[model samples]
Target: MSLLPLSLACWNYDRTEALANGSVRPEGIDLNFQALEVEETFFRMLRHHEFDAAELSMSSYCVTLARDNPPFVAIPVFPSRLFRHSCIFVSAQSGIERPEDLVGKRIGVPEYQMTAPVWIRGILQDEYGVDPASVTYFTGGEEQPGREEKLKLDLPEKFRLEPISPDKTLSRMLADGEIDALHTARTPSTFYSEPDAVRRLFPDFVPVEKDYYTRTGIFPIMHVVALRREVYEANRWIARSLFKAFCEAQRRLYDELLITASLKTMLPWQIAAVEETVALLGEDWWPYGFSRNRAAIDTFLRYHHEQGLSSRRLQPEELFAEETFESFLI
Candidate 1:
């Protein structure tokens, strides 16, 4: 059997470090792993098809599904999962005390169609009775200035979004009181330099996020591994082979978390945290595959469609390659 040489672009995460470093490579693949920030990977992959396979934003991926000809198909491998509650930051002096208080305020985002902002906006509207149209949006860079959306979206007429000048960053705007709040994946520098300038919308997001998980069981998936559709069609077996490699890599990470006696982690209670998380989410907490994560994926598609990002609600089956849908009993 001939092996394929392929490019895989993704972020640098401990769980995926094995794949990047070739410690656990996909069978039959010679992978050129390009580790980069999420925004950069998503932009390059979605725009230029820069890699044969890449970790891509879920929201932008959904949008692509609605387009006439989607360029890629995804595997259920989610490299990043986060609860967006902590992503919301507000000016300390803004007087916006709760989620409901965002109704008439100005919020800044790196991109409206970005996965993190989609989750943030969807959660606010669903849990807090705040329509996206009720608030104004400012789109720009979070720390450095002049960022633009990777793709275009036809946001509703009532939903106001202003493109900030290339010179003005969201962090600076929030600190200067130009914007009332900031909704971004990046932690803006203003919060670090001037701690008093801003505070998290959920001051202690852990409890709120825990309650949210109890209610919805959504850990909030950020990125999915996508393969160029042409490449997938040409070499269908690679999908399952790749999925298996990712699963093994993830299992190695989870197994290491159980190494408490020797202290695999620097934190004194790192093992305890891992044990507690398993008790809460389940043994295979950070799972891949459709069956394990159907509810979260379904809910995300619903929000994406409702928010006018996707032309239609794309099902999990529709977006992922068929080879990745099943696994053998080994």
Candidate 2:
């Protein structure tokens, strides 16, 4: 039988490397995996429908669902999961010492609809009583000029979002004290070049992030594998096939991490790090299925709606292809 040809664009993540390198082919599919940066993949896929499938921003996917005839349908296969406490940078001279101090301040974001800032805004509101509507958000490129939101956002009147001048980058604005803080996925160049000018809101972020996880079991999913809706409508079984392949790839990675005789990765303490993570989070620390991640998904959906991104609160079950929610028993 001839396999169906399918193209996918995503970053070269360790968990998905097997799929990219052709070691783990999805059942009945000839995968053309293009390894690209997250931003490029998102832009090409979101703007042009460049691939059959791609790693999509979680918040962006939810936003699309609000529109008639949403472009993509996702599997629960998450390529990136992060605790975003370390992503918040505040101007040292702005006198924003605590999360509460962010209220009424001008904050720069690469895009107001980006997944990282959605999670950050949600966390601040839930954990520290910082309302999402209180701060005025300045949106634009983080490092370069002429960046814009990929999707048009019809946010509520309470939220204040403005675009920085075409020539101005958020990193420079934050460093120059033009914006009081920045919530972003990538660390701004200014954070390293002008350390005194920009500092992490949570200087000791590891402990704070760990505590946030303990209190709320959300590791915060950033990106999900999305199939173009037309492709998914034609071959629904591909969802399960791809989901199984991704899970198998991740399982191989987990097994590789447990080999203590010689370090499989560059880190000298990879074993210790894995052990600590397992102790903090259970054996299935990075889960992929719907049931396993329902709470986290629900939390993010609520955040999307509360922050005026999603038109209505979407159920977690509505986010993925129906075939991905379960499997046949052996």
Candidate 3:
């Protein structure tokens, strides 16, 4: 039988390296895995549908689902997961010492609908009682010029979001106190270049993020692997095949990380770090599949709806292909 040719665009994550290097091939699929930067992959896939499959922003994917016919369908394979407490930056002049201080302040974000900001805003509201509607949001490029939301949003009147000037970037704006704070996925250049001007909201974020996980059990998901709807419609079996392959790849990564004889990564204490994470989050800390992530997915969906990103609340099951929800018993 001929293998179905499929092109996937994603970052070079250690977990997915097996797929990219051709060490693990998806069943009945000719995988053309393109290791591209996350931003580039998202731009090309969301704007032009350039690949058969791609790693997509979870928030953006949810935004697409609000449409009459979403262009893509997702498998449960998450390529990126992050704890975003460290992503929040505040201006020295902003007088924002705590999360509650962000109320009635101006926050710059690369995009209002980006996953990191969505999670940050939601976290602020749920954990800190800082209502998202109380603060105004300025959207623009982070370090470059002329950046805009990849998809059009029809956010309600309660959410005050405006675009910064085409030439202005969020990093500079935050340092100059043009915006009181910044919520972003990437650390801005100004954070290092203008240390006195820009500082992390949680200067010691490691403990804060770990505490958040202890309370909420949500190690936030940033990205998911998605297939073009046309491709999924014609070849439904690829969802399961690709999901199994990603699982296999992740298992290999775990094995590599456990090899204490020689460190699989550059970190001299890589095993110690892994041990610490397992102690905190259990053996399968970074889990895939619908059932394992239902709480986190449900929380994010609620945030999506509350923040006016999704027109209606979406269920956890609605986000993934049905085939990925379960596996056949051996």
Candidate 2: count the clashes.
0
lDDT of model number 2: 0.94
Per-residue CA lDDT of model 1 for 103-146, tens digit only, reads 99999998888888888988999999988778889998888888
List clash counts for every candidate, in order. Answer: 0, 0, 0
- Report the lDDT tens digits of candidate 3 across residue range 1-330: 999999999999999999999999999999999999999999999999999999999999999998889999999888899999999999999999999999999999999999999999999999999998999999999999889999999999999988999988999999999999999999999999999999999999999999999998998999999999999999998999999999999999988999988888999889999999999999888998888899999999999999999989999888888888775311
Which residues of candidate 1, in runs, are more than 4 Å off? 327-330
Query: Where does model 3 exceed 4 Å of error?
Result: 327-330
lDDT of each: 0.87, 0.94, 0.94
lDDT of 2 by residue, 1-330 (tens): 999999999999999989989999999999999999999999998899999999999999998998899999999999999999999999987899999999999999999999999999999999999999999999999999999999999999999999999999999999999999999999999999999999999999999999999988889999999999999999988999999999999999998898988888899999999999999998879999898899999999999999999988999989999888875312
| Ten residues in sequence with the least summed lDDT for candidate 1 | 321-330
Error in Å for residue 296 of model 3: 0.2
The TM-score of candidate 2 is: 0.98
TM-scores of the candidates in the order shown:
0.96, 0.98, 0.98
Candidate 3 lDDT score at position 274? 98
